[model samples]
Target: MRLFRPSRRAASLSVVLAATLLATAACSGDDAAGGSGDDVVEVNFGYIPDFNGTSLLAVAQDQGLWEKHGVEVEATSFTNGPLQIQALGTGDLDFGYIGPGAFWLPASGQAKIVAMNTLGQADRVVAQPGIDSIEDLEGKKVAIPEGTSGDMILTLALQDAGMTKDDVEIVPMEPAAIVAALSSGKVDGAGFWYPALATVKKQVPDLVELAENGDFEDTVAFPTAFVAGNDVVADDEEKVDRVLAALRDAIAYRADHMDETIELTAEFNDLPVADVRADAENVQVLDLEEIDGYTQDGTFDTWLSGMQDYFVQSGQLPEAVEPSEFYTGDLFLGAGE
Candidate 1:
């Protein structure tokens, strides 16, 4: 049996559904979280319902951290960021936990990033063992999901090797399909996120980890973050701050209780605890105090700006936008305060 959920990997979260969700968000009013009183703010939050940074939101819910911060977090499950950001833009959602699409949605004026949830450390480039380095893969076939952290990191790794996408044969495939293609040696290499990446490694132990975002820490910054509606920052900055404060509490709690964090997230995601723990080990979960260091330093800026350039180069985006066009750094800087 496969270790990961195929539903999460499937393209059920297509852009067409993003439009439909945006059009009918007003009718889907089922509540998911909150407190009894009216004074307590009700935040209808959206997230992918699986392991990964979604676990942090699970922590906040299980620990009652949202209530502690004078807000009620109503959780909604959206399979992808585009749909969530569309709902956010229409004022149906207060916030979303998302991946690389965080930058693109914001570039289009749909979302504003208030806090980062985790780094994009789980995506990796794996190849046949003999192909030792990224440079060795030039002129070879590599499969990946277009417009994801995996593709972005692979592109960066190749560029760092003094080559470009033009140097390789790019075959677009879904995560599970990439796993099969790479394992059978039908493709020279592939890029994937955890569980899928982990799956392929277990199935073929000799696969070379050609390069990942971690390899280019000096030049790349890929993060998954808590994105707010652009309108929320403009209209209800107070509520947005409250959500940030609650997330700060969750971040601190996660740092101190890794074992328990793993257990809870696995249960919340309905997966084996061991699977969730393995995935957890692959990420750098940021804490409240560390937030400033990431934002005040150039790392955060480099990540968002770099991702924009990657999107444009990949043709996922038409052109690059000023950081201000897609991001609100001030909101993230002041999230904990």
Candidate 2:
């Protein structure tokens, strides 16, 4: 049995890596299997086994961008951010793609942020038809992956709607289970993200979106990001930058080649092309120039810092870590200058 099963995204790489990579104790930088070529840097990059988390990775894997940048990416999938953070701390994973846990891992000093992957646009309060608003969800069952951005959004939505967690039965389930539950009427609704978010709605077309990433924008921004282990940031600048350069290229490719991005993601992850395309449309990733602006104008910092404070108030984090401690913004395409 695969110890870690697929949660939000497709499992093409996860299935292979679970049996192969997870079998290995660790694949840290110093101990990773050597590339056939000497100049190639080997990186153990971890991501959630889903479309939003794995899109750029899918692009890099399919488009030959990693090899073009002289890096050999060992793509690994985790069920969630903390698992990746555990691997990073133990020198197993060098970097990760993470969502809500992005805030906790960094704030708890378990990981460090390197770059933004998606700007928290994929999650929403999805419900069965006739349930048209957040208040309608009161006294009902709603499924959400615990500690995810979706969870945060729902918490705030409840407050805004004049309800509380107690007002609804919050059913904590895996992404796959959430899909099944919502479709079967086991859950009246879900605070969820793609591609599972897209999957459930497509499976049951009458599902209604009660609130979404944009609705929570006035409260917080749930960004998914590529995060690195502490040691890598402290010493391995070249390796860090090389990986970033390759990812940056993948981002550039994803912006204009969205069709290719959707197709490649579906192909690599064994997901339905239509649903994958829909999920792709549902989320948003920043381009290089936008990333630069976020970094320079302090919007990016504000986005995360405010969100972190809410995380503290929401009792997810005991306290906040200085942005400098959690975010190494100077590493990517010349940010933090």
Per TM-score, the best of the predicted structures is 2
Q: Can you give the lDDT of residue 323 in candidate 2?
A: 75
Cα lDDT of model 2 by residue, 115-175, tens digit: 8777757778888889999999989999988877778778878878888889999898877
Best by lDDT: 2
User: Each candidate's lDDT (Cα)?
Assistant: 0.75, 0.78
Per-model root-mean-square deviation over C-alphas: 16.3, 14.8
TM-score of each: 0.75, 0.81
Candidate 1: stretches off by over 4 Å: 1-36, 49-51, 74-83, 86-93, 100-102, 128-141, 180-186, 296-299, 306-325, 332-337
Model 2, which residues run further than 4 Å from truth? 1-36, 335-337
Predicted candidate 1 versus true structure: per-residue lDDT over 1-337, tens digit per residue: 7695546435566656887987566333322223334547888998875565577788887898876666877788875566777798788998887777346767656678787777667778888879988888888999987656677778777777888888889998866688898778899987667766667777788888877667877755777888888778889977887788778788889888888888888877788888888887777877766766767775677777777777777677787767765566676667546
For candidate 1, give the lDDT.
0.75
